[model samples]
Target chain A: MKWADIKEKLRWCAYLASEAYNMPYRSTVARARREQDDLFMLLIFSEMMGIPNPATYYTLELQPIMLERFHDWHTRMGMEHSPLDGFRCC
Target chain B: MHRLFDRRIIFVGGKGGVGKTTIAGALALMAADGGRTTLLVSTDPAHSLGDVFDMPIGNEETPLGPNLSGLEIDPEAEAERHIATVKMSMKSLVAPKMYGAIDRQIELARHSPGTMEAALLERMADLMVDARSRFDLLIFDTAPSGHTIRLLSLPELMAAWIDGMMSYRDRSRRLGEVLKVFSRDQSKEDGFGMIGGSQDEPDDSRDGRIKEILMTRRRKFHRARELLTDASTTAFLLVLNAERLPILESKKTLDLLSKFNVPVAGMIVNRLLPPDAGGDFLRERRLQEDEYREEIDQTFAGLRRIYLHLLPHDVHGVETLREIGEAMAEQLGGAFGAAKAP
Candidate 1:
């Protein structure tokens, strides 16, 4: 093999090695991110989910932007039906 | 030393039917007559500014007199406009099929109780930031005491909420960046992938747009809260009748405004019985008023107070409001100390 080919192979080995070493940290981060995202979705859609959010007016503008993602969010959270009355994402 | 005429922003608020609109209009007239450009805005949904000015004053600024302008805010209309604007903004983020569902969602939110107040407060905040540059005095004839208090308190509440949301976004971004885990795997692996963004489009702008919106709103709310709480620049003129309920309500309002650091410039005691009317019924009513006035003096001690007598004439048109304005001249103008309310 050419010298450049050997160097490229070595670089790939190092890259994969680093990724493997950081696997535990990556999983923990992924879990943390999932939890954070769940909390955030809850904060924004708590009113829709039947939680009385006193600050609903302040969050109303964010609803349209979050609508498309609502489908994915509810389904991922195992909601059989859309929690909001008259709003069917399915 | 808060002078009524010296403040740039004034909110005239009180219990319903306490002549807050008339008082606010009178103050605006005085400011205009003093050569200060004035805008009289009514945030009360049951608007009588048009009746007070005897002219059609809508949402936009309409010239009432020389250097005086009027605008009446309709909370329901504002709420509709707000929803429409949000819908327009989300057009690119939503699919054509999802429009009906999204419209229904926003429509439900529009009918919510706090929605009207929120709309009114947002318009008030917008006026505060936008009109401060053009007008020397911005007089807000707010709704009744309870409604106005909620509107005033919302600026700080909204600012804190936006701040919390932005900080959360920042922390989440930092977590990904610091861990060097910012990858493109979410679109492929996660169930909660982005909504309508194209695959070729970078993931940064969606959250960036939310951050931008949050930042803009935060600045407006922060500026509004700053202006409202700044005792030197803004003053809340409390108007109330010399009756029992209004007096008690005014005391509660005073406490609430003080707690929020919103300075109460003075009190205008409306509809006091005149002494010259000599009848047994009049005498008894005046006696009751005298007692309430005493309570007012005790409750609102150290605050400059203006006492206005019951006028048989309707407080309409420039001539009537001018009469009320002149009555306020002595105590409020500070230039004319001996004059009294008619």
Candidate 2:
């Protein structure tokens, strides 16, 4: 057998062996990702929280794409219900 | 002299009721008569360009003469229009399911305090950036003193804000990339057979879109600031009366303008009492006027000053503006007439 072929088979076996076990860091990575998303949304949408942003008009178009995550963000920040839950058609 | 008319952009500002609109209109007329295509724009929410011209000018550009065009931008209307345009652009980008909620948020933003000023400044910056190629001169009849200063300074403030946002976005993006690598490695260890497809990173379309929008605004503000602070191209004319209050206000405003690197073109002492009035009451008023004029000359020393007589009637219509323009032309003389650019 060629050296390259032997190396490739060994790597595949190692990957298959590692795949047999569960990982503990999965939940932590997910939480970090969510927090980053929340921070980004907050920077753009703080005008909605009664903070005056001069560039709010420019960011209005960003609302549609951010709408789905916005709900989860508000809830995670301790709101039992969405502020615009009544207007929610999604 | 002709130097004022030679500038690309001129901003006329003063205390309310000091005839800024009238002076701005006359300046525009003079520039146009000099064979330059001039645009006179009013940035006041409470517009009076129509009153000054004695013609019904709206929020859009209205031609007043062969070479002069006038635009009266209302802050409220401009804010609404900005919102509408943003919403329309979002129509194709935003999913239908989330439309109603986003629309409500945008409507609420319309009533916010800074939103109107932002919209107005954005429109002004747009004009400065986009209209540079189309007109020889742009004369702005600005809102009452303080508001106009704020409007003039917005480009710098917004540029700083954009810088902050841009850096924050870059940091967050880098963090996201790092976290993605970590997650991919963790999934690999768990033998999930390449979770998230291994090569497929999270969708960063939002970051790209936001960065594009911010970058465009930053460029506009950068150009606007450069144009505004370039003394060779921009001039700020302070219109004031010879009375104590306007003179004091003008002094403070001049200090503010120079401090901000805005070129102080000159001061126009509008509404001077005529010297030939033949009554004791008029004589007494003239004596006091002489004292104030002397003080004005002393206070604003070394600056080009123009003194104009108070007209018998309220200045209205194109004919009166032309007459005033001619009078101003005589006072300016032919000295310092060469346009200097460095």
Candidate 3:
């Protein structure tokens, strides 16, 4: 999946989690989700920005697992109606 | 002053991002102003004592005001110290070949569940006994409420474990001594003495000194629990703004604390809209403030309530702290004054 697609899905997942917890979708939730996505993107951006990935680097192999966990968590929490649900590429 | 104050340890704890440090610091100042020598120590791993006081408070105690000092205890440093103590004790008994394995075990012991709280409790117990003569009051600016409870409960949990270990240690010591005597090797005498130096060794002269210290810690825990429940000695002044999210979180925290039998002493409604006559924006803000203030009062009923006007800038430095302190003192009714004698 492309980075943009992953970002969109994660944002939806974040909103779903917040809604499940009965938290308001205010600036705090937006900021928290944005921060989490920013962290996720920073690592990939670092690698693309000429940072060396040694033999132990396995970022490519972990993307599917991370997405699966996010999907599993949302599904288990009964948050299947999120707008970005059908956007998963994997 | 109540006799409970003499043997009490006060721990101020709440959720993170709540103004626990500020309230703890202000209470210490109030106690000092009331002529009690108070030591406010932070047991939070992520400390904000320096930020709260706007002064450098390293590992060692730094004087904040007359009769008031603050210390920030670093849990990592404490864990290291505990690991070393355990390694030294284990080295005296286990075979030389097993020393490396034993050392690794001691290192891994730091990662065990509740080890952080246990080590912190041991350090606190030591400090309480060591400073028994220096300070009259010990105020802990504890971590969030969950962590604080875990830390406070460490003494009882550790005492139970110590009881079981003491019997095993005593048997091992006797067996080592007997083996040494049969071998007739005086060189092993000193080695066998090491195993006998467990913490349970009863001293005839001091009688129950160690037991007294443990008992004092247990009493301190009970006293802290009481003060938290009692509205007089301790007051949980929650600092919350007039926002829905923070208000909800504060109310939830109050509910949890009440459920756990920890009293909500009072609520400090911070950053409220001023009563200034202004445009529509100000009017809307004022309406929101009124709504939230009513919500706070209704949610946390049966406790004293105070409102603090929103300040333009962040509260920092001694000067700002003093100004905020004065404002808070006024709202809460003049610092050390009796709580309306109701």
Best by DockQ: 1
Best by TM-score: 1
Query: What are the per-model DockQ values?
Result: 0.40, 0.34, 0.01
Q: Which stretches of candidate 1 lie over 4 Å from their true place?
A: A1-17, B179-202, B332-342
Global fold similarity of model 3 (TM-score): 0.57
Q: What is the C-alpha lDDT of each candidate?
A: 0.79, 0.78, 0.56
Which stretches of model 3 miss by more than 4 angstroms? A1-90, B1-9, B124-132, B149-237, B255-260, B277-282, B334-342
Best by lDDT: 1
| Residues B93-141, model 2: lDDT tens digits | 5567657766776788788778888888988988887777989999999
Q: What is model 2's DockQ versus the real complex?
A: 0.34
Interface RMSD of 2: 3.6
Interface RMSD for model 3 amounts to 27.8
Estimate the TM-score of every prediction.
0.89, 0.86, 0.57
Ordered by TM-score, highest first, the candidates read: 1, 2, 3
lDDT of 2 by residue, A29-62 (tens): 4456567667767767777776677767666656
In every candidate, what fraction of the native interface contacts is reproduced?
A: 0.33, 0.31, 0.00
| Inter-residue clash pairs, candidate 3 | none
Specify the poorest-scoring 10-residue window by lDDT in model 1 chain A: A30-39
